[model samples]
Target: MAVSQTADTEELMTCLRIQLYHPEPQNIFSSLPMDNRLKQEAEDPVRLGRAAEACPFVLNDTKVSRKQLALMAFRVPGSTEMRFHVQNLSRKGRLQVNGIELRHLVGAELPDKALIRFGRYEMLVLREPGDSETHFEVLFERRIVAPSQEMGEGEARTVPVMESEDVTLSWREPINEPSESDEYQNC
Candidate 1:
């Protein structure tokens, strides 16, 4: 009976592979590399922040708060499939998953493939069906389209660009100019 229970526990284990990228490599700080890989098991929630002692995956940036966020793994009732959720922990630095923004203490279910951005750093999170074995892979960079190619030839127009690799302009609505009160919200 004990053996059967251990097997069941092992079967519920899942792995997450996070590949970090810096869009502006030249401007990146010396502490942050251009591309990095981090792998973790879904057993415990993983914390991410600027503090090395508190977070296993340390993001060394001034814009990043001491406690930025956490990723937790869970399984739905009556299902063996593992799922992940992200919680924003920083009161100042907002977290962006895909194209949606999450404020402090807010959490959302993470997709199998998600583009996460915080503190000028971007990471691609991929869910894998397995134990805590480590894996690494390179992520594709966002393609830059010239303004002239996307807009009408004669008319001068400005387009809002989302830095995430998975997001496209087609579905995104144009953002209005920020008000005076909204300007300092992120600060």
Candidate 2:
């Protein structure tokens, strides 16, 4: 249908058309107008470069040290037991985080008290599990955006490994219980 070449077409209708139900999650990471834009190819098709902060990293309490934490961003007072895949670029080791990981915070409904935190000349997440968003001083250091592909060098392997309801934090394989081989031990 050759639509009208009229002077006016409703902007809301145009927006709805663009908002078709794509299987992929919506990009909630909107940046300021002045913020420059760049493109990167990561596990997700294409992403904003300069606006890396907009990628939507969330954190919970105790999952990180109170000291300098870089390459992390955002915090939330939350619940709903969740797991997150965080990009850690620090000295490798197991670390305790008291709340849900930030990776899973994507597309999450944020609380009124939730505030984003960035630290260590980069960015990290801060979380408070009980949704207690009182006047907590959410301090963090701003950092330059690191390319998603450029992983920092570390001797230890760090990734999300979840067991039990309480998420135990670790930088390397725990020396105590081996992750496997206990299968047949019960026999």
lDDT tens digits by residue: candidate 2, 50-144 = 22443222222233322212222233247432222233232332222223233311222222222222231122333323222221212222223
> What is the per-residue lDDT of model 1 for residues 96-144, given as tens digits with 9 covering 90 to 100?
7665677788877776766676865666676665443222222223323
Residue pairs with backbone overlap in model 1: none
Model 2 regions lying over 4 Å from their true place:
1-48, 51-79, 88-120, 130-187
TM-score of each: 0.57, 0.19
What is the TM-score (0 to 1) of candidate 2?
0.19
